[model samples]
Target: MNSTSSSDSNGPKSFSVNFNQDASSLQVGCRNGYRLYELSSVDSLELVYSNGAEDSNLVERLFCSSLVAVVSLTSPRKLKVCHFKKGTEICNYSYSNTILSVKLNRSRLIVCLEESLYIHDIRNMGVLHTIRDTPPNPSGLCALSINHENCYVAYPGSSSIGEVQVFDAVNLHAKTMIHAHDSTLAALSFSSSGTRIATASEKGTVIRVFSVVDASKLYEFRRGMKRCVAISCLAFSLCGQFLSCSSNTETVHIFKLEDPHNSPRRSVEESSWMGYLTNYLPTQVTDVFTQGRAFATAYLPFCGVKNAIAIATIQHQLRLLVATESGVLYIYNIDPNEPGDAVLYKEHRLDAVPENFDKTDKGRSSSPQNIEGILGSYAGIVKGNPPGQMSGTESDKLREMAAAAESPPKGAFQFSDDQEYPPLTQISD
Candidate 1:
C-alpha cells in the first residue's frame, strides 16, 4: 500500500469532493467554501479558482467542465451557479427548506429538496419540471447520468419503501418507476449510456440493476448479509462494463455486468444438473451458488479512517479514486479479471502545504512527522473480509440472505394498492 500526507495547516476537517465526469478536475466543498482544482498533474493539485466563504455542504464541477455549483446547508439554504473561469455567479437560487442535493449536466440543473425536485434549464435557469412529495430523503439519494445525449436522473419514489423514479433529461418527464426493495432507498446510479440504472436500499444487502427502457430487473448482486450498512456512493465505468459501490465500510464491491446477448451459457451437463437441483434447493442455496460469481472486490489499504463518501473511476484504467471524511484520498488499481481485492496504487492527502510555510518554519523543527502515527487510531476503514458472499454462522447467513432476497408485492405500483401517495407539494417557485 502507498500513502502520503499534506503539510498544509488549513486543510478541511470534513469535505465533499467530486471529480468531473472525465476525472480531469476536482471540486471540493468545505467549511471554508469551495475551490476548484486541476487534476492534470498527478503530483500536485493546482488551484484554478477559489470562492472563499464560511461553509458549503456540496460542490460539484458539472460534467468535468468549467461550470460549478454549490449548495449551502446553513440557514437560508441557497444554490449558487457560477462560471469557473470568470469566478462570476451565473445564477443564485434560494429555498425555504434545506437543499439536500444538487446535480447538473450540460443541459439541466437538478436541485433536490427534502420532498421535492426541481429541474431547470442550465442556460437560463428556467424551471422545466417539478416533482413533489418525494420519499423522506435525508441523504439526498439522487443520481444523474453523465451522458449528455441520453441523460437520466433517478431519485427515490414518493413512497416509504424502495421505489425509484427515473426522469428523462431533456424534458424532466417521468420515464418509469422501479420497485427496487422493501426498505428505504439509500443510493441510485445510472450506467454510462443511461440504458441501465442501479439501486441500493437502506438495507444495503443487495444491489439491483434495472433497464431504464422497460424498468425490468437485469441483475442482482449480493453485497452483504447480517448487517445493514449505508451505501454512500455508486459509480459506473465510462464504458458501462463494470460498477463500483462504496459504503460506510472500508471495502468497495465491484460487479461485472452480465451481457444478455454475449454472455456464455453454461454447458448442457452443468446447466441441466444445476438447474434441476436449484429448483428444489432453498433460496439460500441459490444465493450461495451465485455469491461472488464473475465479480471482484476491493478494500481500503489503510485502517483507522472513515468510509469513503465519494468514488470515481479513471477512464481507460482499472484505477479508482476514493475520498474519506478525514480528507485522505486512496487510489486503487483493480483487476477486473481477478477474483481478489484491489491493490493500493497510491494514497495522498487532499490538502496542500501552506504558502507561507518557509517564513513561519524558520525557527521550528524541519523534520516532518507521520500524521497517522501522531493522530493515533481514529475511526477509519475497518479491515476485514471484503463485502459480498455469506459470512458468520451458517444459520445467520441463511436467514439474512433469505430476507434480502424476498420479493416486494407484485403490481404494488397500481393505484388499487395501499402504497401511500402523499400529495404533490411544490416547494420551489
Candidate 2:
C-alpha cells in the first residue's frame, strides 16, 4: 500500500529521523522543529510531543524511552536535552567543534566530536570521561552495545590502517584494540550482547566480526570485491546470531554467526566425515576455509535508489526496517530458512507534511492537527507479527542450506597451502 503526506510551502526542506530501540517511537528533526510520533499504527500518527527549533540537524530519542536530545546545524554544535512529555528543555551542553554523533541510553550519553569523544552521566549530565586525539572520524561513526551492565563502545582507533578501539562504557577504560582491516575504516558495530564487534573497511568487500574481550577475529564475511563500496550501517540481531550490513548501493546483506549453542545438529553421515575432520583441525585453519559466507541478501524496493541510509532490526524477528535517501522507508520480512532474498513487506513515505503546516508559528502549539492519521500512515506499515521463533523444520532447512553453501563445488580444484588464493570476486545481484 502507498500513503503520501500532504506537502506545504512552509514544510521542511529535509528531515533527519530516528527510531527508538523497539521501534515504538519515531523522532523526526526538520528545519523548523522536531516531531515525536508513536509508530504503533500506520493509518494514523499519535503525536507525543513537538519541539520547535531553528535548523535542527539531528533528533534522537533515548534508547527505550521518551526523553530526547536534539542538535542544530549551527556553529560549535550543542545538544539540547528535553523532556518529550512536557516539552521543557532540562539542560543543554555545548562543544567546541561540530558534533559528529550522539548516543544515549538510560545511564549514559555519548557525544563524538572530530578528534574527541565525551561520555556523560545521564542522570545529572556530569562529564564522565573524555577521550582525546581519537582517530579522524568525519562521519562520526560510533557504536554502543545494548548491554547495560557491561556496556561497550567501539570507534576508530587511528588514522593509519583500519583499527577499532573497544572500551568499557562505564569506567572509560580501554578494553581491547583490534587491527581489523587494511584500508580505511568505514563502519563499526557491537553485538547486542556486547561480546563481539563488527568492522568494515573503505574497500567494503570484507566485514569482520571480532571478540570484544581478547580482540580475536571470529567471523569474516565478504560483501563484494569487484569495486570499492562505502558501508553506511551495520547492525547485529538482538540474539547476536546475525549481522546485517548496508552499503552505498541498492542491497543489504545479512551474515550468520557461528553459534554452536543454537545451531542445528548435523546429519549422521555428514557429521561422521566432514564435521569430524574439521573438528580436529586448528581454529586458524578452519577460519581460512569458512570465510566470506553470507546467509542471505536483498535489494532495496525502490527504483533508482541512491543508497540505504539506515537499518534497524526487531529482536527475534527476521524483519528489517530500511530507510533510503529518497525519504522512503521499506519494511522487509525475511525468512532465513529459505534460500532466496528477503521480500518487501511495506513502504512508507516519511517526508510528507500536513496540509495546514505553518512554518511561521514557531511553538509547540504548531503541531499538525491530524497527527494520528499522518503519523499512523508511517507506523501502520510495520504492524504485523513480532519476531518469529525458529521451528525444528526451519532450523533443519537452514543447516542444510548453510552446509551446501559453505562447501566447495564437487570436483572444483583446491588451492594448495603454498599457492596464493585468487582475489575475491564480486557476484552480481
Steric overlap count per candidate: 3, 13
The TM-scores, one per candidate, come to: 0.73, 0.70
lDDT of 2 at 218: 84
Error of 2 at 360 (Å): 17
| Poorest stretch of ten by lDDT in candidate 2 | 416-425
Report the CA-based lDDT of candidate 2 relative to the real structure: 0.62
Off by over 4 Å in 2: 1-13, 41-47, 260-289, 302-317, 354-429
User: Evaluated with lDDT, which candidate comes out highest?
Assistant: 2
Error of 2 at 331 (Å): 0.4
Structural RMSD, model 2: 20.1
